[model samples]
Target: MSVKSIVAIVVSLIILVAGVSSVYVVDEREQAIVVKFGEPKRTVTTPGLHFKIPVMEQVIFLEKRILSLDVPPQEVLASDQRRILVDSFARYRIADPLKRYQAARTEVGAARLLEDAMESTVRQVLAKEPMNEIVSGQRAELMKKISDLTNQRALTFGLEVVDVRLKRVDLPRENSEAIFRRMETERQREAAEKRASGQRDAVKIRAAADRQVAEILAEAERQSQTIRGEADGQAVKIFADAYGRDEDFFEFYRTMQAYRKSLGKDDTRLVLSPDSEFFKLFMDNK
Candidate 1:
Protein backbone atom coordinates (compact mmCIF):
# COMPACT_ATOMS: atom_id res chain seq x y z
CA MET A 1 0.00 0.00 0.00
CA SER A 2 1.09 3.54 -0.64
CA VAL A 3 1.75 6.07 2.14
CA LYS A 4 -0.90 8.51 0.74
CA SER A 5 -3.53 5.68 0.80
CA ILE A 6 -2.73 4.96 4.52
CA VAL A 7 -3.06 8.70 5.51
CA ALA A 8 -6.39 9.09 3.67
CA ILE A 9 -7.80 5.96 5.38
CA VAL A 10 -6.81 7.29 8.83
CA VAL A 11 -8.53 10.66 8.17
CA SER A 12 -11.73 8.92 7.05
CA LEU A 13 -11.87 6.83 10.23
CA ILE A 14 -11.41 9.95 12.40
CA ILE A 15 -14.24 11.76 10.55
CA LEU A 16 -16.53 8.78 11.02
CA VAL A 17 -15.78 8.70 14.78
CA ALA A 18 -16.46 12.44 15.11
CA GLY A 19 -19.72 12.23 13.17
CA VAL A 20 -20.96 9.36 15.37
CA SER A 21 -20.10 11.27 18.52
CA SER A 22 -21.95 14.40 17.32
CA VAL A 23 -25.26 12.53 16.93
CA TYR A 24 -27.12 10.85 19.88
CA VAL A 25 -30.57 9.27 20.11
CA VAL A 26 -33.19 10.28 22.70
CA ASP A 27 -35.67 7.61 23.93
CA GLU A 28 -39.41 8.23 24.19
CA ARG A 29 -39.33 7.45 27.93
CA GLU A 30 -36.60 10.04 28.59
CA GLN A 31 -35.98 13.79 28.28
CA ALA A 32 -32.52 15.35 27.85
CA ILE A 33 -30.53 18.50 28.38
CA VAL A 34 -27.50 19.63 26.41
CA VAL A 35 -24.67 21.21 28.40
CA LYS A 36 -21.87 23.03 26.68
CA PHE A 37 -18.77 23.63 28.76
CA GLY A 38 -20.71 22.77 31.96
CA GLU A 39 -23.55 25.21 31.03
CA PRO A 40 -27.05 24.02 30.05
CA LYS A 41 -27.80 25.01 26.44
CA ARG A 42 -31.31 23.65 25.76
CA THR A 43 -33.84 21.09 27.00
CA VAL A 44 -35.28 18.47 24.59
CA THR A 45 -38.25 16.27 25.40
CA THR A 46 -38.80 14.96 21.85
CA PRO A 47 -37.68 11.38 21.12
CA GLY A 48 -35.49 11.39 17.95
CA LEU A 49 -31.96 11.69 16.67
CA HIS A 50 -30.36 14.85 18.04
CA PHE A 51 -27.09 16.73 17.34
CA LYS A 52 -24.58 18.49 19.58
CA ILE A 53 -21.03 19.83 19.35
CA PRO A 54 -18.89 16.70 19.05
CA VAL A 55 -16.24 17.56 21.70
CA MET A 56 -17.57 20.55 23.68
CA GLU A 57 -21.21 19.61 24.31
CA GLN A 58 -22.77 16.72 26.35
CA VAL A 59 -26.32 15.36 26.66
CA ILE A 60 -27.88 14.46 29.99
CA PHE A 61 -30.93 12.14 29.75
CA LEU A 62 -33.59 12.16 32.47
CA GLU A 63 -36.66 10.01 33.08
CA LYS A 64 -39.73 11.73 31.61
CA ARG A 65 -42.30 9.35 33.15
CA ILE A 66 -43.53 9.24 36.72
CA LEU A 67 -41.27 7.49 39.22
CA SER A 68 -41.91 5.75 42.53
CA LEU A 69 -39.76 6.00 45.66
CA ASP A 70 -40.15 3.69 48.63
CA VAL A 71 -38.90 5.35 51.76
CA PRO A 72 -37.38 3.34 54.57
CA PRO A 73 -39.07 3.03 57.96
CA GLN A 74 -38.57 6.11 60.11
CA GLU A 75 -39.21 6.60 63.82
CA VAL A 76 -41.09 9.77 64.62
CA LEU A 77 -42.67 11.36 67.66
CA ALA A 78 -46.36 12.27 67.46
CA SER A 79 -48.09 15.26 69.01
CA ASP A 80 -49.46 12.98 71.70
CA GLN A 81 -45.87 12.21 72.74
CA ARG A 82 -45.93 8.69 71.41
CA ARG A 83 -43.19 7.08 69.36
CA ILE A 84 -44.28 5.49 66.07
CA LEU A 85 -42.61 3.70 63.17
CA VAL A 86 -43.67 4.75 59.66
CA ASP A 87 -43.14 3.19 56.24
CA SER A 88 -43.95 5.46 53.32
CA PHE A 89 -43.63 6.07 49.55
CA ALA A 90 -43.95 8.84 46.99
CA ARG A 91 -44.65 9.20 43.24
CA TYR A 92 -42.88 11.94 41.34
CA ARG A 93 -41.66 13.17 37.94
CA ILE A 94 -38.85 15.31 36.63
CA ALA A 95 -40.69 18.42 35.58
CA ASP A 96 -37.55 20.45 34.65
CA PRO A 97 -34.61 18.57 33.22
CA LEU A 98 -32.13 21.45 33.52
CA LYS A 99 -33.08 22.13 37.10
CA ARG A 100 -32.92 18.41 37.93
CA TYR A 101 -29.44 18.20 36.43
CA GLN A 102 -28.35 21.28 38.33
CA ALA A 103 -29.67 19.88 41.63
CA ALA A 104 -28.35 16.34 41.16
CA ARG A 105 -26.51 14.94 38.14
CA THR A 106 -28.07 11.45 38.13
CA GLU A 107 -31.43 9.85 38.88
CA VAL A 108 -29.97 7.92 41.79
CA GLY A 109 -28.67 11.14 43.36
CA ALA A 110 -32.00 12.86 42.77
CA ALA A 111 -33.74 9.95 44.47
CA ARG A 112 -31.61 10.41 47.55
CA LEU A 113 -32.45 14.07 47.63
CA LEU A 114 -36.14 13.36 47.32
CA GLU A 115 -35.90 10.74 50.08
CA ASP A 116 -34.39 13.26 52.47
CA ALA A 117 -37.09 15.75 51.62
CA MET A 118 -39.79 13.17 52.21
CA GLU A 119 -38.30 12.13 55.52
CA SER A 120 -38.06 15.68 56.75
CA THR A 121 -41.53 16.55 55.51
CA VAL A 122 -43.06 13.43 57.01
CA ARG A 123 -41.48 14.12 60.38
CA GLN A 124 -42.57 17.71 60.39
CA VAL A 125 -46.17 16.99 59.47
CA LEU A 126 -46.60 13.86 61.56
CA ALA A 127 -45.16 15.50 64.64
CA LYS A 128 -48.02 17.94 64.59
CA GLU A 129 -50.61 15.14 64.45
CA PRO A 130 -51.73 12.95 67.28
CA MET A 131 -50.79 9.26 67.30
CA ASN A 132 -54.40 8.12 66.99
CA GLU A 133 -54.96 10.21 63.87
CA ILE A 134 -51.75 8.98 62.28
CA VAL A 135 -52.60 5.32 62.89
CA SER A 136 -56.37 5.31 62.56
CA GLY A 137 -58.99 6.23 59.95
CA GLN A 138 -57.81 9.83 59.97
CA ARG A 139 -54.50 8.76 58.43
CA ALA A 140 -55.72 9.81 54.99
CA GLU A 141 -56.12 13.39 56.13
CA LEU A 142 -52.65 13.45 57.61
CA MET A 143 -51.14 11.91 54.48
CA LYS A 144 -52.70 14.65 52.40
CA LYS A 145 -50.99 17.19 54.58
CA ILE A 146 -47.71 15.39 54.23
CA SER A 147 -48.06 15.16 50.47
CA ASP A 148 -48.82 18.83 50.18
CA LEU A 149 -45.85 19.75 52.33
CA THR A 150 -43.53 17.39 50.48
CA ASN A 151 -44.65 18.81 47.13
CA GLN A 152 -43.49 22.20 48.29
CA ARG A 153 -40.08 20.80 49.15
CA ALA A 154 -39.82 18.88 45.84
CA LEU A 155 -40.18 22.03 43.77
CA THR A 156 -36.70 23.06 44.83
CA PHE A 157 -35.29 19.92 43.20
CA GLY A 158 -37.15 20.51 39.91
CA LEU A 159 -39.42 17.55 40.78
CA GLU A 160 -43.20 17.35 40.85
CA VAL A 161 -44.81 15.11 43.49
CA VAL A 162 -47.88 13.18 42.33
CA ASP A 163 -48.83 11.62 45.64
CA VAL A 164 -47.42 10.59 49.01
CA ARG A 165 -48.82 7.89 51.30
CA LEU A 166 -48.02 6.06 54.50
CA LYS A 167 -47.98 2.34 53.93
CA ARG A 168 -47.81 1.31 57.58
CA VAL A 169 -47.92 3.09 60.91
CA ASP A 170 -47.66 1.42 64.28
CA LEU A 171 -46.48 1.90 67.83
CA PRO A 172 -42.95 0.98 68.82
CA ARG A 173 -42.37 -2.56 70.02
CA GLU A 174 -41.88 -1.61 73.66
CA ASN A 175 -44.98 0.59 73.62
CA SER A 176 -47.15 -2.17 72.21
CA GLU A 177 -45.91 -4.68 74.75
CA ALA A 178 -46.52 -2.27 77.59
CA ILE A 179 -50.09 -1.64 76.48
CA PHE A 180 -50.72 -5.39 76.23
CA ARG A 181 -49.50 -5.95 79.75
CA ARG A 182 -51.66 -3.16 81.13
CA MET A 183 -54.75 -4.52 79.36
CA GLU A 184 -54.07 -7.97 80.75
CA THR A 185 -53.77 -6.65 84.28
CA GLU A 186 -57.02 -4.75 83.95
CA ARG A 187 -58.85 -7.84 82.69
CA GLN A 188 -57.47 -9.96 85.52
CA ARG A 189 -58.66 -7.51 88.12
CA GLU A 190 -62.13 -7.48 86.60
CA ALA A 191 -62.25 -11.29 86.63
CA ALA A 192 -61.28 -11.41 90.28
CA GLU A 193 -64.03 -8.97 91.21
CA LYS A 194 -66.62 -11.05 89.37
CA ARG A 195 -65.51 -14.22 91.15
CA ALA A 196 -65.72 -12.56 94.54
CA SER A 197 -69.24 -11.33 93.82
CA GLY A 198 -70.34 -14.80 92.75
CA GLN A 199 -68.90 -16.39 95.91
CA ARG A 200 -70.65 -13.84 98.14
CA ASP A 201 -73.96 -14.56 96.47
CA ALA A 202 -73.37 -18.29 96.88
CA VAL A 203 -72.78 -17.87 100.61
CA LYS A 204 -75.99 -15.88 101.03
CA ILE A 205 -77.98 -18.52 99.15
CA ARG A 206 -76.56 -21.34 101.29
CA ALA A 207 -77.36 -19.48 104.52
CA ALA A 208 -80.94 -18.90 103.38
CA ALA A 209 -81.38 -22.59 102.47
CA ASP A 210 -80.05 -23.68 105.89
CA ARG A 211 -82.46 -21.38 107.71
CA GLN A 212 -85.39 -22.73 105.69
CA VAL A 213 -84.44 -26.33 106.53
CA ALA A 214 -84.17 -25.54 110.27
CA GLU A 215 -87.61 -23.92 110.32
CA ILE A 216 -89.20 -26.87 108.50
CA LEU A 217 -87.66 -29.41 110.90
CA ALA A 218 -88.78 -27.45 113.99
CA GLU A 219 -92.39 -27.17 112.73
CA ALA A 220 -92.51 -30.89 111.86
CA GLU A 221 -91.23 -31.87 115.34
CA ARG A 222 -93.81 -29.68 117.11
CA GLN A 223 -96.70 -31.12 115.02
CA SER A 224 -95.52 -34.72 115.66
CA GLN A 225 -95.36 -34.12 119.45
CA THR A 226 -98.90 -32.66 119.51
CA ILE A 227 -100.32 -35.63 117.58
CA ARG A 228 -98.58 -38.12 119.92
CA GLY A 229 -99.98 -36.38 123.00
CA GLU A 230 -103.55 -36.49 121.60
CA ALA A 231 -103.21 -40.17 120.69
CA ASP A 232 -101.98 -41.08 124.21
CA GLY A 233 -104.83 -39.19 125.92
CA GLN A 234 -107.48 -40.97 123.76
CA ALA A 235 -106.00 -44.39 124.64
CA VAL A 236 -106.10 -43.63 128.40
CA LYS A 237 -109.78 -42.52 128.22
CA ILE A 238 -110.77 -45.76 126.36
CA PHE A 239 -108.99 -47.83 129.02
CA ALA A 240 -110.89 -46.09 131.87
CA ASP A 241 -114.27 -46.60 130.15
CA ALA A 242 -113.53 -50.34 129.68
CA TYR A 243 -112.64 -50.71 133.37
CA GLY A 244 -115.87 -49.04 134.55
CA ARG A 245 -118.06 -51.20 132.26
CA ASP A 246 -116.85 -54.53 133.90
CA GLU A 247 -114.66 -54.33 137.01
CA ASP A 248 -114.27 -58.14 137.54
CA PHE A 249 -113.61 -58.80 133.81
CA PHE A 250 -111.03 -55.96 133.75
CA GLU A 251 -109.28 -57.43 136.86
CA PHE A 252 -109.16 -60.90 135.24
CA TYR A 253 -107.83 -59.46 132.00
CA ARG A 254 -105.15 -57.50 133.95
CA THR A 255 -104.07 -60.67 135.87
CA MET A 256 -103.84 -62.64 132.55
CA GLN A 257 -101.70 -59.90 130.97
CA ALA A 258 -99.39 -59.88 134.05
CA TYR A 259 -98.94 -63.66 133.94
CA ARG A 260 -98.18 -63.65 130.17
CA LYS A 261 -95.53 -60.95 130.63
CA SER A 262 -93.85 -62.67 133.64
CA LEU A 263 -93.61 -66.11 131.92
CA GLY A 264 -93.04 -64.86 128.36
CA LYS A 265 -89.30 -65.76 128.41
CA ASP A 266 -87.85 -69.28 128.79
CA ASP A 267 -85.88 -68.18 131.92
CA THR A 268 -89.06 -67.25 133.91
CA ARG A 269 -89.24 -68.63 137.51
CA LEU A 270 -91.89 -68.05 140.20
CA VAL A 271 -92.62 -69.69 143.61
CA LEU A 272 -96.23 -69.76 145.03
CA SER A 273 -98.68 -72.19 146.74
CA PRO A 274 -101.08 -73.94 144.30
CA ASP A 275 -104.18 -73.18 146.50
CA SER A 276 -103.06 -69.54 147.36
CA GLU A 277 -105.23 -66.43 146.75
CA PHE A 278 -103.15 -65.46 143.69
CA PHE A 279 -104.29 -68.73 142.07
CA LYS A 280 -107.96 -68.34 142.95
CA LEU A 281 -108.92 -67.46 139.37
CA PHE A 282 -106.86 -70.34 137.97
CA MET A 283 -108.44 -72.84 140.50
CA ASP A 284 -112.01 -71.67 139.71
CA ASN A 285 -111.42 -71.99 135.98
CA LYS A 286 -110.06 -75.53 136.43
Candidate 2:
Protein backbone atom coordinates (compact mmCIF):
# COMPACT_ATOMS: atom_id res chain seq x y z
CA MET A 1 0.00 0.00 0.00
CA SER A 2 1.17 3.56 -0.73
CA VAL A 3 1.76 6.14 2.08
CA LYS A 4 -1.22 8.28 0.87
CA SER A 5 -3.52 5.26 0.95
CA ILE A 6 -2.34 4.37 4.49
CA VAL A 7 -3.04 7.96 5.69
CA ALA A 8 -6.54 7.82 4.16
CA ILE A 9 -7.30 4.53 5.94
CA VAL A 10 -6.12 6.02 9.28
CA VAL A 11 -8.43 9.04 8.80
CA SER A 12 -11.40 6.77 8.02
CA LEU A 13 -10.85 4.75 11.21
CA ILE A 14 -10.58 7.90 13.32
CA ILE A 15 -13.83 9.27 11.84
CA LEU A 16 -15.55 5.99 12.50
CA VAL A 17 -14.38 5.92 16.10
CA ALA A 18 -15.37 9.57 16.63
CA GLY A 19 -18.80 9.05 15.07
CA VAL A 20 -19.45 5.98 17.17
CA SER A 21 -18.37 7.83 20.33
CA SER A 22 -20.43 10.95 19.51
CA VAL A 23 -23.66 8.96 19.16
CA TYR A 24 -25.03 7.39 22.32
CA VAL A 25 -28.44 5.69 22.64
CA VAL A 26 -30.57 6.27 25.67
CA ASP A 27 -33.02 3.46 26.41
CA GLU A 28 -36.60 3.83 27.65
CA ARG A 29 -35.57 2.77 31.13
CA GLU A 30 -32.73 5.27 31.42
CA GLN A 31 -32.07 9.01 31.60
CA ALA A 32 -28.79 10.64 30.65
CA ILE A 33 -26.92 13.88 31.26
CA VAL A 34 -24.13 15.16 29.01
CA VAL A 35 -21.18 16.66 30.79
CA LYS A 36 -18.68 18.88 28.99
CA PHE A 37 -15.33 19.50 30.67
CA GLY A 38 -16.68 18.48 34.12
CA GLU A 39 -19.72 20.73 33.78
CA PRO A 40 -23.24 19.57 32.97
CA LYS A 41 -24.11 20.44 29.38
CA ARG A 42 -27.64 19.03 29.02
CA THR A 43 -29.90 16.42 30.48
CA VAL A 44 -31.83 14.04 28.16
CA THR A 45 -34.79 12.16 29.62
CA THR A 46 -36.43 11.05 26.39
CA PRO A 47 -35.27 7.74 24.97
CA GLY A 48 -33.56 8.10 21.55
CA LEU A 49 -30.25 8.42 19.73
CA HIS A 50 -28.48 11.63 20.74
CA PHE A 51 -25.27 13.30 19.36
CA LYS A 52 -22.63 15.19 21.24
CA ILE A 53 -19.07 16.48 20.71
CA PRO A 54 -17.05 13.28 20.52
CA VAL A 55 -14.09 14.02 22.81
CA MET A 56 -15.49 17.01 24.72
CA GLU A 57 -18.92 15.60 25.80
CA GLN A 58 -19.44 12.54 27.94
CA VAL A 59 -22.77 10.79 28.68
CA ILE A 60 -23.83 9.90 32.20
CA PHE A 61 -26.63 7.35 32.44
CA LEU A 62 -29.17 7.40 35.31
CA GLU A 63 -32.07 5.11 36.04
CA LYS A 64 -35.44 6.46 34.96
CA ARG A 65 -37.25 3.53 36.52
CA ILE A 66 -38.14 3.53 40.20
CA LEU A 67 -35.29 2.28 42.37
CA SER A 68 -35.29 0.65 45.76
CA LEU A 69 -32.89 1.08 48.67
CA ASP A 70 -33.02 -1.04 51.75
CA VAL A 71 -31.80 0.73 54.81
CA PRO A 72 -29.80 -1.18 57.36
CA PRO A 73 -31.31 -1.83 60.77
CA GLN A 74 -30.99 1.18 63.03
CA GLU A 75 -31.42 1.45 66.76
CA VAL A 76 -33.61 4.36 67.76
CA LEU A 77 -35.24 5.59 70.91
CA ALA A 78 -38.99 6.08 70.83
CA SER A 79 -40.90 8.99 72.35
CA ASP A 80 -41.74 6.72 75.24
CA GLN A 81 -38.06 6.35 76.02
CA ARG A 82 -37.97 2.78 74.75
CA ARG A 83 -35.17 1.58 72.49
CA ILE A 84 -36.09 -0.39 69.37
CA LEU A 85 -34.54 -1.71 66.16
CA VAL A 86 -36.03 -0.39 62.95
CA ASP A 87 -35.52 -1.94 59.54
CA SER A 88 -36.74 0.30 56.78
CA PHE A 89 -36.52 0.81 53.01
CA ALA A 90 -37.54 3.33 50.38
CA ARG A 91 -38.40 3.70 46.68
CA TYR A 92 -37.21 6.70 44.70
CA ARG A 93 -36.54 8.05 41.21
CA ILE A 94 -34.30 10.68 39.70
CA ALA A 95 -36.62 13.55 38.98
CA ASP A 96 -34.02 16.03 37.77
CA PRO A 97 -30.95 14.50 36.16
CA LEU A 98 -28.90 17.69 36.06
CA LYS A 99 -29.43 18.38 39.72
CA ARG A 100 -28.88 14.70 40.53
CA TYR A 101 -25.62 14.68 38.58
CA GLN A 102 -24.48 17.86 40.32
CA ALA A 103 -25.34 16.47 43.75
CA ALA A 104 -24.48 12.76 43.29
CA ARG A 105 -22.43 11.81 40.26
CA THR A 106 -23.48 8.16 40.08
CA GLU A 107 -26.41 5.94 40.93
CA VAL A 108 -24.50 4.50 43.88
CA GLY A 109 -23.76 7.97 45.16
CA ALA A 110 -27.39 8.92 44.78
CA ALA A 111 -28.45 5.86 46.72
CA ARG A 112 -26.04 6.70 49.50
CA LEU A 113 -27.28 10.23 49.76
CA LEU A 114 -30.89 9.08 49.70
CA GLU A 115 -30.19 6.57 52.45
CA ASP A 116 -28.87 9.35 54.64
CA ALA A 117 -31.82 11.57 53.85
CA MET A 118 -34.33 8.83 54.53
CA GLU A 119 -32.63 7.77 57.74
CA SER A 120 -32.61 11.30 59.03
CA THR A 121 -36.25 11.74 58.19
CA VAL A 122 -37.17 8.47 59.89
CA ARG A 123 -35.38 9.41 63.08
CA GLN A 124 -36.94 12.85 63.13
CA VAL A 125 -40.47 11.62 62.58
CA LEU A 126 -40.36 8.52 64.80
CA ALA A 127 -38.79 10.28 67.75
CA LYS A 128 -42.08 12.03 68.34
CA GLU A 129 -44.12 8.83 68.61
CA PRO A 130 -44.08 5.86 70.92
CA MET A 131 -43.42 2.26 69.91
CA ASN A 132 -47.12 1.40 70.10
CA GLU A 133 -48.04 4.16 67.70
CA ILE A 134 -45.38 3.10 65.27
CA VAL A 135 -46.58 -0.52 65.35
CA SER A 136 -50.28 0.19 65.31
CA GLY A 137 -52.64 1.05 62.46
CA GLN A 138 -51.29 4.59 62.63
CA ARG A 139 -48.02 3.26 61.24
CA ALA A 140 -49.13 4.11 57.69
CA GLU A 141 -49.65 7.71 58.74
CA LEU A 142 -46.26 7.79 60.36
CA MET A 143 -44.60 6.36 57.25
CA LYS A 144 -46.34 8.97 55.10
CA LYS A 145 -44.95 11.68 57.29
CA ILE A 146 -41.47 10.30 56.89
CA SER A 147 -41.87 9.95 53.15
CA ASP A 148 -43.08 13.50 52.75
CA LEU A 149 -40.27 14.84 54.84
CA THR A 150 -37.71 12.82 52.90
CA ASN A 151 -39.12 13.97 49.57
CA GLN A 152 -38.88 17.57 50.66
CA ARG A 153 -35.32 17.15 51.79
CA ALA A 154 -34.38 15.15 48.70
CA LEU A 155 -35.70 17.82 46.34
CA THR A 156 -32.32 19.54 46.18
CA PHE A 157 -30.72 16.22 45.18
CA GLY A 158 -33.26 15.84 42.35
CA LEU A 159 -34.74 12.74 43.91
CA GLU A 160 -38.43 12.09 44.24
CA VAL A 161 -39.01 9.80 47.18
CA VAL A 162 -42.00 7.68 46.26
CA ASP A 163 -42.50 5.69 49.44
CA VAL A 164 -40.90 4.97 52.77
CA ARG A 165 -41.70 1.79 54.65
CA LEU A 166 -40.78 0.11 57.88
CA LYS A 167 -40.26 -3.60 57.40
CA ARG A 168 -39.85 -4.40 61.06
CA VAL A 169 -39.92 -2.51 64.31
CA ASP A 170 -38.93 -4.75 67.17
CA LEU A 171 -37.90 -4.35 70.75
CA PRO A 172 -34.53 -5.58 71.83
CA ARG A 173 -34.49 -9.21 72.89
CA GLU A 174 -33.97 -8.32 76.54
CA ASN A 175 -36.86 -5.89 76.53
CA SER A 176 -39.15 -8.30 74.67
CA GLU A 177 -38.55 -11.03 77.21
CA ALA A 178 -39.35 -8.69 80.06
CA ILE A 179 -42.52 -7.54 78.35
CA PHE A 180 -43.57 -11.11 77.76
CA ARG A 181 -43.12 -11.94 81.40
CA ARG A 182 -45.19 -8.98 82.43
CA MET A 183 -47.89 -9.86 79.93
CA GLU A 184 -47.99 -13.41 81.17
CA THR A 185 -48.38 -12.21 84.73
CA GLU A 186 -51.17 -9.85 83.78
CA ARG A 187 -52.99 -12.59 81.87
CA GLN A 188 -52.68 -15.01 84.75
CA ARG A 189 -54.03 -12.44 87.15
CA GLU A 190 -56.99 -11.73 84.88
CA ALA A 191 -57.70 -15.44 84.56
CA ALA A 192 -57.63 -15.88 88.32
CA GLU A 193 -60.01 -13.00 88.78
CA LYS A 194 -62.40 -14.48 86.24
CA ARG A 195 -62.30 -17.88 87.92
CA ALA A 196 -63.00 -16.37 91.32
CA SER A 197 -65.87 -14.37 89.94
CA GLY A 198 -67.29 -17.47 88.25
CA GLN A 199 -67.02 -19.47 91.47
CA ARG A 200 -68.83 -16.81 93.42
CA ASP A 201 -71.60 -16.73 90.84
CA ALA A 202 -71.87 -20.52 90.97
CA VAL A 203 -72.20 -20.43 94.76
CA LYS A 204 -74.90 -17.78 94.57
CA ILE A 205 -76.79 -19.78 91.96
CA ARG A 206 -76.54 -22.97 93.98
CA ALA A 207 -77.80 -21.24 97.09
CA ALA A 208 -80.73 -19.75 95.25
CA ALA A 209 -81.61 -23.11 93.72
CA ASP A 210 -81.42 -24.81 97.10
CA ARG A 211 -83.62 -22.19 98.69
CA GLN A 212 -86.16 -22.52 95.88
CA VAL A 213 -86.19 -26.34 96.18
CA ALA A 214 -86.74 -26.15 99.93
CA GLU A 215 -89.58 -23.66 99.51
CA ILE A 216 -91.24 -25.87 96.85
CA LEU A 217 -90.92 -29.01 98.97
CA ALA A 218 -92.27 -27.26 102.06
CA GLU A 219 -95.27 -25.95 100.11
CA ALA A 220 -95.96 -29.43 98.73
CA GLU A 221 -95.78 -31.02 102.21
CA ARG A 222 -98.10 -28.39 103.64
CA GLN A 223 -100.60 -29.00 100.83
CA SER A 224 -100.39 -32.79 101.40
CA GLN A 225 -101.08 -32.39 105.17
CA THR A 226 -104.04 -30.09 104.51
CA ILE A 227 -105.52 -32.66 102.08
CA ARG A 228 -104.98 -35.49 104.61
CA GLY A 229 -106.74 -33.52 107.37
CA GLU A 230 -109.72 -32.72 105.10
CA ALA A 231 -109.98 -36.43 104.16
CA ASP A 232 -109.93 -37.48 107.84
CA GLY A 233 -112.70 -34.98 108.64
CA GLN A 234 -114.76 -36.25 105.69
CA ALA A 235 -114.35 -39.84 106.88
CA VAL A 236 -115.53 -38.91 110.35
CA LYS A 237 -118.59 -37.10 108.94
CA ILE A 238 -119.47 -40.15 106.78
CA PHE A 239 -119.17 -42.52 109.76
CA ALA A 240 -121.43 -40.27 111.84
CA ASP A 241 -124.03 -40.09 109.09
CA ALA A 242 -124.10 -43.91 108.75
CA TYR A 243 -124.30 -44.38 112.50
CA GLY A 244 -127.21 -41.89 112.76
CA ARG A 245 -129.10 -43.79 110.05
CA ASP A 246 -128.93 -47.22 111.82
CA GLU A 247 -127.71 -47.01 115.38
CA ASP A 248 -128.37 -50.66 116.42
CA PHE A 249 -126.90 -52.12 113.24
CA PHE A 250 -123.85 -49.90 113.51
CA GLU A 251 -123.34 -50.93 117.17
CA PHE A 252 -123.65 -54.59 116.29
CA TYR A 253 -121.28 -54.22 113.37
CA ARG A 254 -118.77 -52.30 115.55
CA THR A 255 -119.01 -54.95 118.25
CA MET A 256 -118.42 -57.77 115.75
CA GLN A 257 -115.41 -55.86 114.30
CA ALA A 258 -113.97 -55.44 117.80
CA TYR A 259 -114.45 -59.08 118.63
CA ARG A 260 -112.82 -60.21 115.41
CA LYS A 261 -109.92 -57.80 115.94
CA SER A 262 -109.47 -59.07 119.53
CA LEU A 263 -109.86 -62.79 118.85
CA GLY A 264 -108.53 -63.42 115.35
CA LYS A 265 -105.78 -65.92 116.40
CA ASP A 266 -105.89 -69.03 118.38
CA ASP A 267 -103.13 -67.81 120.61
CA THR A 268 -105.49 -65.00 121.84
CA ARG A 269 -107.64 -65.64 124.96
CA LEU A 270 -109.97 -63.32 126.94
CA VAL A 271 -111.04 -63.93 130.58
CA LEU A 272 -114.62 -62.58 130.37
CA SER A 273 -118.02 -63.79 131.58
CA PRO A 274 -119.90 -66.06 129.16
CA ASP A 275 -122.93 -63.77 129.40
CA SER A 276 -120.84 -60.64 128.66
CA GLU A 277 -121.88 -58.44 125.71
CA PHE A 278 -118.52 -59.10 124.05
CA PHE A 279 -119.34 -62.86 123.88
CA LYS A 280 -123.07 -62.43 123.11
CA LEU A 281 -122.47 -62.64 119.36
CA PHE A 282 -120.33 -65.70 119.68
CA MET A 283 -122.95 -67.32 121.86
CA ASP A 284 -125.72 -66.42 119.40
CA ASN A 285 -123.73 -67.81 116.56
CA LYS A 286 -123.06 -70.99 118.46
RMSD of each: 4.0, 3.5
Each model's lDDT? 0.92, 0.92
Residue 185, model 1: Cα distance from true site in angstroms = 2.9
Model 2: weakest 10-residue lDDT segment is 277-286
Top model by TM-score, which number? 2
Where in model 1 is the C-alpha error above 4 Å?
A: 1-4, 216-286
CA lDDT, candidate 1, residue 177: 99
lDDT of 1 by residue, 1-286 (tens): 9999999999999999899999999999999999999899999999999998899999988899999999999999999899999999999999988888899988899999999999999999989988888888588788888898888888888998999989999987898999999999999999999999999999999999999999999999999999999999998898789999998998898888888898899999889889877677778674
Off by over 4 Å in 2: 36-42, 53-57, 73-76, 82-87, 137-140, 166-181, 259-277
